[model samples]
Target chain A: MEKELKKIEKVISNLELNSQAQIQELLKNFLKTHLKKSKIDNFIGDYPTFIEPVYLNVNVKIGDDVLLGPNVYIGKNTEIKNYVEISNSIIFDNALIGENVKLNNCIIGKNTLLNCENINIDNCVLVGNVKTKEDVYRIMYKFK
Target chain B: MSEKRKQEIQRIKELESINLARDEIRDLVIDTKKEVEKDNDLLAAQINDELNKRGIKSIDIVGAIGAGKTAILEKITEKLSKKYRILVICGDITTRVDADRIEKHNAETVQINTGRECALNAYHINQVIKNKDLFDFDLIFVENVGNLICPSDFKLGTDKRITVVSITEGEWVIEKHPMLFKMSDIAVINKIDLLERLGTNIDKMIKDACGFNPDIKVITTSAKTGENIDTLIEALEL
Candidate 1:
């Protein structure tokens, strides 16, 4: 029985040392290597917010505080500002994210993000492609 | 060397081979997991938000030229626009003619004549939504520039996509313009009242619609006479 245990240990040790699979090897190395917690802050700014503490993952970076939905997917290296609310979509990084916006199936810009509120995206990609001097607004008008 | 020793050595070598392969597979799974994690996280966030505030949803309506989309929009908005918060946008190469007609329905409308159609993306749709305050509206409707080609390649960021087809065009529409039907999430047979006069077979049309999306919901309607328009409304409302 002792010999069998030794054999099993040997198999595990062998697996630990192998690196044939690229991602596995990367993950293995990540596991085996030392890791330091990133200093970058990713959090919802607290102050008169509807709900506190937008659910976050290890990879995302948030500003002071942002209102977030349950399925908001923040990609690696994303930097979200305070007072931003995102729901149901992938938000990529350094994204100058705006406040009070809802998104879905939308890929924000590599460098493009909006600061305007009351925006919603569906199955689309917005690069903040062009710089504008005017702030976009959606207002209600009374029929005369 | 003894046979036993030789056999043990061979077993070790076999184990080493397995270890190599296992490591490789493990790495692949880890990479895949990152993507899946992102997807899962996004889905999780959406669910959390949707549950909390009821939900903010948008719908996209697409069709080919002369599909009578504007006519149908007239019927839809007249009956249900006020009941549901509705935001409307019209697309044409260089004109807001359709938007003018649709605007008569009393929905806040945006006329997006980009001159070029290639730029239609999630980003563009997002802009329109924001500009139109579409999210604030109960139902946001986007009327594509009457072309099935360029629009299909880009996602307009709507929750559901309904493709419109008219019977006056012909029964061969499904067989010829399969891509248009194939790309949309739902297939709508517009101008169905013209079936008998135009020799358009409703069953064959249904079959053709199914060829692209077997589960596709088809409604035969005539805005002219208000036939089966109720079913169309039910499909959209549901």
Candidate 2:
């Protein structure tokens, strides 16, 4: 990661800005370096330019276009879909989540299909191919 | 030639794309691992609260396909419902027929149609359960999506987690899903009538179950033969 970051840094430093497009690439790459370490801000679509870092933010990356409707609470470049509820759910990537789901302490693998709801998952490592018939409510419900 | 430079640039672009992809995946893993660890602690604290409150007498029967979960549910539900005003939550990713099947046994059927997957959390169960008579019923039997691994990970405010496995599946059924077996409060070994024919030793089932959970109550029954049906009923009296 460090080497890759350094290479990207070199590209940012060396890229000749002949047009607005080249300038945009330089800025995006430059921004991604810092953005990688910090939390992303929330927006409907199209991630914003990197400025300041925040704690517990979301980022919607490429291939994650059309993320959560109303796009509440995003990190940096993390892709979510519409119909996904935003209430203390931390999403990773390529996570093909279904509609009207409440996620807490759930680490969904890349490209895993979470096609259900009321899922309270914790202390579990799902390497994709996780299929459920009903909600897996944990001891967390006891607190509520 | 400029062609060589262009090709070099294209190669660099491709490599950069791949690198970006790798970086994104790695960072997500690191961040996710930390987040899940944090969530575990948060959930533990929340669970501690849930347990101290008035826990509903809901039960989640977890097992694999052909483990006779449905049969045990029918047999046990027939009895548990009589005393507890039971409501059966049937989950089968497709069709309400399972709910209908259980309904014939005189229990209100809640068919959770979440495509081809299971509801491994309590929120969805609570969502549908809230619409019904939660307080009126003494027991809400959620027949989980015939999965041992995923169902055990979730604790659905249930008084008991009944794990069903047919003696025909083998004595090693208890060891097949260690996590599920370990999490279960009760282990029902169905098809005990077929034990001799299936060459299953009851002692092995008891030993394996006890190995996972010393407090695990093991009951042997044959839902088809109606053997030990009374015993299953007696166990649920608690």
Candidate 3:
């Protein structure tokens, strides 16, 4: 687990980390390294919490047990699944959020998905039409 | 006289006639604008006197679309509605979105749909005052149509005129719309939360505004964050 974390850190340090694509790559690697330690099960049954007021820029469907943090803006037609945590981020239109996901300080672009369970993301912006966990892995592998 | 000499004279006469006509048209345009301004000023003075007699304070808020003009008004309304009986006259090209928003805060609202008009002129406010019994209201806020150019040209008979400019519109916004800043009593630099993220120098913008209108009062605020909203109310003395 330490070796995997070191590799993820090395990947993040090597990339030109200004753009959203690089941030997404970093988040994916971080999540993959953490997932290997079987932390996914520990995040289950955690109730969603909102630390600050959530601004709904458009009609957004937020399922039960979703935790929205301060200064979070959810665009129209976005669906946040159950037991998801989002904070200080902007989720654009038509994006799908799978259950048991954690997002912090990230921007989720239109029509994207964070379908992976028990993932924690911070200071990242996921762009393009990211649909599945395999897609995230593929992008992260390219960065590596 | 010779035929060639007569032709030259005729040409000169026609050129002189065209110049005279052009000068007359220019003078007519200038005179017409002056007359309109004079009439507007007269009406504005009348409205001001009327409001003063009734012990009502009035202010006109002007800014570009998405410059947080409505949001600033909403914030002001939320804060002032508890103490003052306020009337908000929202000027829009079509919808009553702003008026409806202010009404939600328990303020009396009147929507003036100025279709194809860029600003609310003195006549519009005059008509509304004539139609409504405004004696009960302590304050009146006339939200001009969302345009920086035309709204500055027309005085809506308010005691104070405020122009809201947001940092998200970029640093050159103040320099681009100097006329609005020159005519306004106060200039509000809004959306300060995006100042660092947008890499905008709020001080520079304030300096440019002062250069445009040295007497203009400048305030920085973020309506979304409810920052400096109380200071704005205090500046307005409402």
Candidate 4:
């Protein structure tokens, strides 16, 4: 079992830089090759939420009024405030998102505070602890 | 040796090679910069002599990203384009957005895409000047890449170095990046209009700049409202 786990670790490390589609295909292949049919069926039945579009890898606190779009990754201990809409974005751990904020196609850095109201952010990689209400356009230029 | 021992030896060798490669790259970058600085010193002297002979003026504007460097340039160009034949060289890692904006103000503009370079070296300025007749223009402005650190290290052969810091960048920015202020002839605290909204202490920022460099001329401006722009022009002797 230890040897088999080591083999899986090797595959995962090798596929670290690969595209999402490629990684998913490789993971599926690995699961098919390693797991028994009955075990796979039982695992799928027990954790039926695995097939869902929204994948919550860790414990998150989301408000009831918040709306999340497809392919959202909310990290552990993040507070999604009321009326916030997030889509195609990865919100890192320990972030406090404010009310009525709209984020799309962005990577919210760890320990960030998106406390701006009615702000629309897109294609932005906000650094940790970025406190701003102004329009932050194409912030990737700063990183580069 | 056992299989595990052999694998450990291979891993150590790989790590050593990676460290050696990193050291070599660091050395190469340092040497290249030293050589470039030497070349730049000579080129800058030549550019200065030529500009002095033609009685023309030049200014290099440096600041962090979103610190209102481009906006300040646009405001300055709009005010002086009628009196002086102006030329602006906009430098950035990518995109000609600033160049397009400056061209709209009736200034002859050129865009320098530096690829991965953080600052515009004197070689870039020399090349741009060589292609154009410097005698045709009275004032030249070079809007450097939006970097507070790297741009301070490089001199792009300008008469005045203006560093623009906006209120949006936080108050501690002036104290944090004192080298930029030390090198700059004029330090502009831009986006003063946002002061009430951001609650940034403008007097403290100016005092910090002055404290770092007593000779550095400081101006508080709002490029959006055109506030204290004439004061900036006066400071530049334009």
Candidate 5:
């Protein structure tokens, strides 16, 4: 397993990573080669609708009126605000999915803050870890 | 003061001294060439010869601001470091921000703060190679000062040249900047992951790029999502 992980890292290190779709594909390929089936165990939040098979790592907070996925993976300590929709997407660690944001076929990067409202993002990769609040807000709004 | 802090201060002082020495060399070069014709072709040939003699392959990564030039360099350095020794020369107006980012991936970097100069020239490369030992590295990635205009006019004598244009810059970029594409060996149409959101016709962009230079290889990539990076590596033959 350690050797496999190292091999995966080596492959990832060689590629320019900017899109979540690419990472998703890489992981899927890795899983296909190694493990037969992958499983996710987590508690879903109240009144937050799930399309089923939604994966959440530990400490992921989902808010009311939020719609999660048929294929969604939220990483550790990420907070999802009200009226947000996410499907077929991967949100990395320490991310804040702002209110009224709709995401599909995308990947939200680590330490990213989505501070905007009423924006629809699809087929995009938001490479977070922005230095300032202004930058975070700026990018969140740029997708529209 | 803390030991770490003292060491950092000393490191900064050494950097300042090195920068000063480089500046003196640049000034000397400029003064010596004042009487001579400003022949870029001659200088480019000289740089090419120097690089060839050292058996080093050089790539010039040219792009506008926010076109993911630094991000691409970071990935390239990370991926290729094990196989080959890599040095990234980051050219910027006044900041080492790009160099600092690349160095975090454990890549050797040299920052050329080209104040008042929009493009990196052969003279800068000549001085850099003269100051540093080129035999140490197998590959050199020169991140040209961010802009599509000025860099087209200047040749840095690299083996391969890649021009990165993002979707955020719009479809007209390739049409507007034809000369850069004409001179480039590869044209990277970056930020394809934003195709849906930006409503950009990536096909037309690719077509336009290929139209400008029939031989220029066009690769669509997203630096944020890590899309088509392997293909790009293959395209570069790295």
Candidate 6:
């Protein structure tokens, strides 16, 4: 029984580390390909908001004064409100991103309504009905 | 194995269990969304039957905030009131300001205050008209809550659905909101008088609208200047 338990631990640890590395690699390549095809148009508003250094799906409605990219992917029908800065993130479709939020290295899930303001999310996978103003952080290393 | 090693195995086993449960939860969510859509469709068909029986033609107008949905409706009411008994139903987050504005143009107005709800669903419309005599009007205009995303998912039991956007919203508005264009019967590009000053390419917007929806009718109008309002009326057949 003890030998079997040790083997299981070794297998689980290896699987966790390998999956994390593989996901990071896949997401990086995906964002790189999509960013090359993204078109940055001048968002003509009072504040003059433009998504610089980001890859955006054409169906995203972005508000004024939002800073996006270097490595970001926003999917279709996602509405980003004013004064939000996001970098190195993947926001899925139908997400209602509220105002004054900052995100870095985050993977926001589909149909998630993020109503938080002025909160910084880093190195997290916020998924499935995450509607709160509290600062949330879930490091990816926990899977190991 | 050591004490810590045993705990690690147990934790991995639990994590696998949680992952399986998460997949089930995701499936449940998808099923619920489809169920809601099916219910909305059934309700919309019922409402359409009711409206048809009463000889009332309904239109649901959807757009982003400040996209001139109200301006187009105001112009529509002004022109068609002399010929038809029009009823304008305005859906707002928390104000009757649009209802008041449309009422001035000789249309009976009803205000639906959908507090914090992004979209006006068919169930709300069914309840709104259930108490009223819908036969008194020949046409009904429903201005859905000002949003580009949520309103696209709803069906308001209307004969025609219009998605309105203005040049000031940006030249990419049409491409940025593909779902609304795909579902709408008519796409109105308003505020064209300011097109040159804003330097927006109206052609690109029209092309994008047509690309998403080949069957959709695209009309460029300046509601402020009343340009192409007559053409829009003709398209609406009002």
Tens digits of per-residue lDDT for model 3, B118-144 = 777887787667545677699999998
Which candidate gets the maximum TM-score versus the true structure? 4
Tell me the TM-score of model 1.
Answer: 0.48
Q: What is the C-alpha lDDT profile of model 2 across A33-95, one tens digit per residue?
A: 433332333333442221112222344432221212111223343444443433222333445
lDDT value, residue A102 of candidate 6 = 81
Each model's number of backbone clashes? 28, 32, 1, 0, 9, 1
- Candidate 6: stretches off by over 4 Å: A1-144, B1-24
Q: lDDT of each structure?
A: 0.56, 0.57, 0.74, 0.71, 0.75, 0.75
Better of 1 and 6 by lDDT: 6
Give per-residue CA lDDT, model 4, range B113-156, as digits (tens). 55457887776676567646687899999999999999877777
Per-prediction CA RMSD (Å)? 22.7, 19.2, 22.9, 21.6, 22.6, 22.4
DockQ of each: 0.02, 0.02, 0.01, 0.01, 0.01, 0.01
Error of 1 at B155 (Å): 1.6
**TM-score for the first chain of model 4?**
0.56
Fnat across every predicted model, in order: 0.00, 0.00, 0.00, 0.00, 0.00, 0.00
Candidate 4 on A1-144: residue-level lDDT in tens?
235434433443343333345434433343334321111111111111111023343456655445453335565677777667765555666777777788765566666777666787764556544445753442321211
- Chain A TM-scores, per candidate, are 0.43, 0.36, 0.59, 0.56, 0.66, 0.68
Q: Which 10 consecutive residues of model 6 chain B have the lowest summed lDDT?
A: B109-118
TM-score of each: 0.48, 0.55, 0.56, 0.58, 0.53, 0.57
Instruction: Rate residue A41 of model 6 by lDDT.
Output: 41
* Segments of candidate 3 deviating more than 4 angstroms: A1-144, B1-24
Q: For residues B1-238, could you state the per-residue lDDT of candidate 1 as single tens digits?
A: 9999999999999999999999989978989877755654455345334423545555677777898888888788888776877777666554456767877887766655443343234534544443232246666677877876666655565666788878887777766777667756667788867776787776887898888777678888787787877788888754
Give the fraction of true interface contacts kept by model 1. 0.00
**Reference-based lDDT, residue A89, model 5:** 65
